[model samples]
Target: MSDRSYRFTHAITRKPAASIIAGLRAVDTGTPDLALMQAHHAAYIAALRATGATVIELDALDAYPDSVFVEDTALCLPSGAVTMRPGAPSRLGEAAEMAPHLEALYADVKRISGPDSFIEAGDILMTETEILVGRSARTNAAGIAELAALVAPWGETVREVHTPPGVLHFKTDCSLLDAETILATRRLSATGCFTGYRLIDVAEGEEAAANTIRFNDVVLMPAGFPRTRDALLAAGYDLREIGNSECAKLDGGMSCLSLRFTSKP
Candidate 1:
């Protein structure tokens, strides 16, 4: 399998706005500190830039409290990009806001215009061979089907899977560590959705660490998960731990902070 799936040349991130305190969450942990969240956001962008990739820093969209979780706006692929129709009522406008940005970067960009379809990149994991989309409260069958049809002509295959009950997004429980290896929570891996791939189970109770991203040579994960950190180290992954306390309150993780992709015009 090609490493292009995780190897990115460019990334796009939005600064966390003060309104992020109102960002949607399955449960309210606490109000996010804008200053602290900005600090963490800076560190994240730095880590991505350290890989020698160009990082497009977009201005904050305060009107949308959940805009910082940019991954839900679209799926960026080698062949093209697709703007999603977010299920959350407040998040719906976020997708349209992201479309022009994607158009500027991608030569061919598409949109999930089905009125009833709803998909988020947070619920979609792209592999070297196929795109695995987990059905979640934020992503539905119609959205998955639309995505499949849009990418079919590009030689991409979409496989629908089940996200564990109450999971906010598919990636809330798993992430691709490499072309053939996956870092997943036992809760997600146990579903047998990844039978063919190598698995690295996150340490018990450290399931939040599953929502990590393998970018270039480094794997970025939220800080505070010592056991999961040690396991990834043992596996020889170059890991960078970033403070995520603030974003965590809003159910945001490393993968949610940015959209990583390589596009050629």
Candidate 2:
């Protein structure tokens, strides 16, 4: 019921630029079709609005190829917003670009500023009482240290979780389904990072489905994963499937598409 939970009231998303065709991809899934990705991005913003959030859609940043993934720029906490120090050099400018919008909605905005610190919000998982951070190649110790300090005053605890190899982010392997439930892959589940939560396992061969995002009452999942769809339906969730084939090429998922927050803009 709190802002730290899935009951979001506001969201921030950016339109994907035509330059998104050149977004960084780990395995060379080939360039995404610009027109198709834009259509998908539109539908994603619509989905966020349907969740009852006042969605703020920013103009596309043509200069930044990966600017559409706005969630990586900051962590929206109930108290304020914390700008992230992106691990990817190409994405470093995104934090500054997202500042004006965040400041307009939030009165307080903190940052992780260190010469050696690098953290992407994609590596941090938020819950009602605690935050699980991934010590991935993109997120370093200094970044985690900074986050722990900012959230401590709000009565939130930060715990570090070991990320599996070959993943771009911690959320690439799992996502929170609800307040007490988590949807995760077998690989990440074995890490024992979610020992206290009720975990719902994704269907075999549907590991990518683990990245679904629960906004308010519905879960926005990636389309084309039938087995995983059945798993979520069986779990009693009202689900909405979004096309993500194009975004997946750039290592993005449902959670990376927008920054969901409860504060009114």
lDDT string, candidate 1, 1-265, tens digits: 3787799999999999888888998998888999999999999999999998999999999999999999999999988999999989999999999999999988899999998999999999998989999999999999999999999999999999999999999999999999999999999999999989999999999989999999999999999999999999999999999999999998889999999998664
Model 2: per-residue lDDT, tens digit, 1-265? 3536688888889999988988988898888988888888889889888877788889999989999999999999888899999999999999999988889888888888888889999998998768899989899888998889987887778998978988889999899988889999999999899998999988889888889888988899999889989988987999999999999999999999999888854
Record all residue pairs in model 1 with backbone atoms less than 3 Å apart, i.e. clashing: none
* Every model's TM-score: 0.99, 0.97
Error of 2 at 44 (Å): 1.2
In angstroms, the error of model 1 at 214 is 0.4
The deviation in Å at residue 29 for candidate 2 is: 1.1
Candidate 2 worst ten-residue window by lDDT? 1-10
